[model samples]
Target: MEYPTIEQLHTKLINKEITVADLVAEYVDRAKASDLNAFREIFADTDIAAQVAVAEAMFQQGTATVLTGMPIALKDNILFGGHVVSGSSKMLEHYTASYDATVVAKMKEAGAVIIGRTNMDEFAMGSSTENSAYGPTKNPHDTSKVPGGSSGGSAAAVAAGLCVAAFGSDTGGSIRQPAAFTGIVGLLPTYGSVSRHGLMAMGSSLDVIGPMTHTVGDAKIFYDAFKGKDSYDGTSQEQSIAVSLKKKLAMPKFDKGGIDPEVLSNFEMIVEGLKKEGFTIDEIELPHFADALAVYYILMPAEVSSNLARLDGIRYGDRAESVSINDVYGDTRGALFGPETRRRILVGTYVLSHGYYDAYYNKAVALRATIRKELEQALETYDAILTPTTPTPAFGIGEKVNDPVSMYLSDLFTVPANIAHHPALSVPSGKSAAGLPVGVQFIGARFGEETLFALGKIVEDIR
Candidate 1:
């Protein structure tokens, strides 16, 4: 039950070999029957029928695009008008969207069939989907293991063939890490390249919407459709940058002590394969690279604390009944927010508190700029930066849940790109000895997604 790529489905739809309704129905049935819990809700039949009708008309009218008739899944945090977008939390469990997220609106205009919203970490916190209020999403390759967090459900849905492709927001490796765990392709577009008008903000500066799919080609098609500036989003940029493949990649020096032996071995094989393809690999020095995780932890939570303040019962989400205003705020948050979400909020609040702001938050902000400069300088010499997407393959579901520090370390390799506001692509490199998949990541310069696509395609062919 391998799901076809967007282009493959487009060919079928154009030739009339398969109607959009039939294609969407097949995926809807799979989503309904799957035990992975990848989706929070499979849209009602009437809702899907309406989308199918629009897709059919696009084909009949000869205005169909590459994504027309493709069944796509959205992360639960993304708003879709008239549908419940819970952000995988009880707070917004019954909150229906009043309008579409910019990305959703763009997809609708492209004639992509919206299957349903997939599960995620509560308010996009935690490194495992275990934080999801609805329970965890299992890895398709091994049910005992996790699919990786934040975007775990989106990754699992694609890997399990429940949808043609799915969209996930990458805030500190959410999309790429999950794609690695689930054996799929995930792209973290350059910040500001894709509009974030309606996306639920986790770390506003670090978040970027990207495509998770079986191939880099499919990701490109999906990205091209939804990327552009929007008046609704001031961060959205209109950068006119050139894309060129220098055939040169940068590898930073780092300790492999904590990384899995098999992951390291697989990454070496990928490097060797690329060398044979005439690509040059250079081991370079990035002095501030080691501090990326620390800086990300400080900056991200500060933003999370500020952004989530709106979720206090009154403005949005479910309210807790209490007499005093303070009681209502405290009780509602304490009762509805997951442990991981609450932990971040507390940490964020402490860092931003008056006495500690300069010591923790401000210092982190300065270090973040230093780290970004190091990456940018490195990119100027090399076309892209390379690393294993995650230090280890997918761990057991409850393996790191209780150990917060260990869980945060899972994002070590993938967080640098987000911290630097750069685009990154995670491609399946090979499988580990235990038969779990591992991915190799490519971090390109801002607006250099073309460079990533070019290199990713080569990796696909050689690997």
Candidate 2:
């Protein structure tokens, strides 16, 4: 990696070779100069200086945590108290958070500077940041293409050197896909391993807040800081495990029908590299893989419909006046939400409706459980499972806006991990013929992030 790792920067801070104020100033300058549209705000006033001074004092007192003085970006969906958190939607565009999310509190307690919130798909419903109400975040490597949504802005921010690292919530493949598109490291930690207290809900069962950074080592530094239980979130857990790495990994038997040709070739290259490193590579059957995407679309929008209900124009966003309460609700939501958000809400409500409930929603839930069981059974025999993070590299902006089914196909490989409730990471493997980045993903058992990180370093070292 051209950029220094988090540990190296920490060493410099501890040795008095650099100061927090200086680091923040330089990063702030870089962020301002960026053309990627990565940030929603940059604390252009003295707020950044104020936060840096506190971190500077921690360094002076020799009481700094691993993240002390580090400048990091948070996805717009994450709530940082007293700041506007719109989730890139007009419904909450003018709303301000009342309190910080648990993860934000943890980062602040550790002395990390919260630079600003980055852009995302409105309500995190789209696969590309082009759906953002503000504007699409351009890929740093190639502006004509997307940086992947809904965490596109955060990934772009890190890749463009605007921040040392950034946090993005992955509902399906939001974080991992964007990281892959931008050629950075992205980790979707085990479900329940990190608190979702402050992250805006997309799919309650699927959302995860994770790191985007230049290298896997930097990702570890960020992950270790906030992966734990929080009373505010019912699903959060204090998952404890001893770190271990086996010299073997596994991949599913390929069903070449849906995968992009370049992605398959990249997967082959990764397999060859792992074999050269003396790690055994085996192909196992995951028959359920074929049905994963269909399963995800059903469950995700159902959750999306349920979670977004609280944002009534009366309580949360721009209001509409009418004598009838129904019109107030309809007009407000209809006008404020984007087309994709409305579509999902309608689909979600339809599936959860009376006659269709058992046919669609219930069946999907049952299949989801079976998928999780099959994955757990597979993990017993393999250290980790590998696949391409995204089926193709970043598509051009507006290319799939009118084609929702094709857009959803982008998450073909990633949705399975979220459905199975396992942890996964996207490591930049190689470049596509178009010179865009290609990502290979590793899915491990719950709380198996350590093994993924270890292998991710090997892949990073491949270059």
Candidate 3:
């Protein structure tokens, strides 16, 4: 059965058409019976009863919000007090969060019932959920294909109707890519617009938490509920800009060799459709744009190495017994950290090493600033930059697992937004000939979420 959207469900609850318990019970049963492997754990009714009661009271007191009683899921990397959040890694398999993530707290304040923590790539280090310590999350569209990662579990949960909405963190396209692969909407808010406190850090400068949903409107509702300045996150700040559309969208000219023919065809069709809707499509030249993936690889892994260093066995998670402290650290990480996590750590450490810092890391840093400036300059005239979210639709599971470079390329178009600290949204453009979903992304200027939302809705409606 297709589940009601957040707003639709809200109306039903307000009209007494259904109770919160009934809704939660239905989704819980479905989640339990599913074989998608989308969730790490579904909170027992006993664990959720208090929130249900709180939501029920909010309605009774006429203080309910759109999210009240909505059964939502959080990506495993997000912290929810009293729940185990392992970041889909064996290293933290038994680790419990002592406090809530800021976004989790916001959702609770809005009377949302967080249903469970979904699976992901171990330590948010892979492009496919196959890297998860538990298991890969299969795409809801086809059991044989991957849903995309490290937010694959959350993407699958929402796509499979296991929950009304799910929250996922994006560090180099984790959220958007999976959302595209699963035929849903994903938003990557401007970096630092959403608090990162309690989110297991992968790349601190590149990470932002956002919502995955079936509709653009739902994404906006979820974003509004949680985004703002945070005392817990020094990098967080509130967005106050009022964005009005300029009716102009910029499409970058780039090599099409790597992109699937069908995907490019679908995108061209979307561009033509928008032109018919009276929006101007400008082919703009952003020279540094083509270097996004290269820059992201260097900068993100560098941040990953630094942020993940704190996860030493002694401080937080599973530890290997050894006679020496060095052996303990070495053995624990080697045994518990997945291959993708280890690979990134090694690459990160290499680039940040004293002898190579100026050669690799510093050059990438300089190039990053150039790319950001190019994007900012383009957005000064264009409302948003548009592109297909991924080069192709969901590939078969394990297809790219052994080919790490191919997997990294999965984030091609989406990484530029993170590199530039701009907001980007992925909306289902249409389905491929094989019936897989193809997503179109809109990259807006910083604090231009409203512009992206407006553009995303148009893509959603046209589809």
What residue pairs are clashing in model 3? none
For model 1, name the residue pairs that clash: none
* Residue runs of model 2 more than 4 Å from their true location after superposition: none
> What's the TM-score of every candidate structure?
0.99, 0.98, 0.99
Least accurate 10 contiguous residues by lDDT in model 2? 239-248
What root-mean-square deviation over C-alphas does model 3 reach? 0.9
How much is 110 displaced in model 1, in angstroms?
0.7
lDDT by residue (137-239, candidate 1, tens digit) is: 9999999999998999999999999999999999999999999999899999999999998789889989899999989999999999999899998999877
Can you write out model 3's per-residue Cα lDDT over 41-113, one digit (the tens) per residue? 9998888788899999999999999999999999999999989999999999999999999999999999999
Residue 438, candidate 1: Cα error in Å is 0.6
Q: In model 1, which runs have C-alpha deviations exceeding 4 angstroms? A: none
* RMSD, one per candidate, in order: 0.9, 1.2, 0.9
What's the number of clashes in each of the models?
0, 0, 0
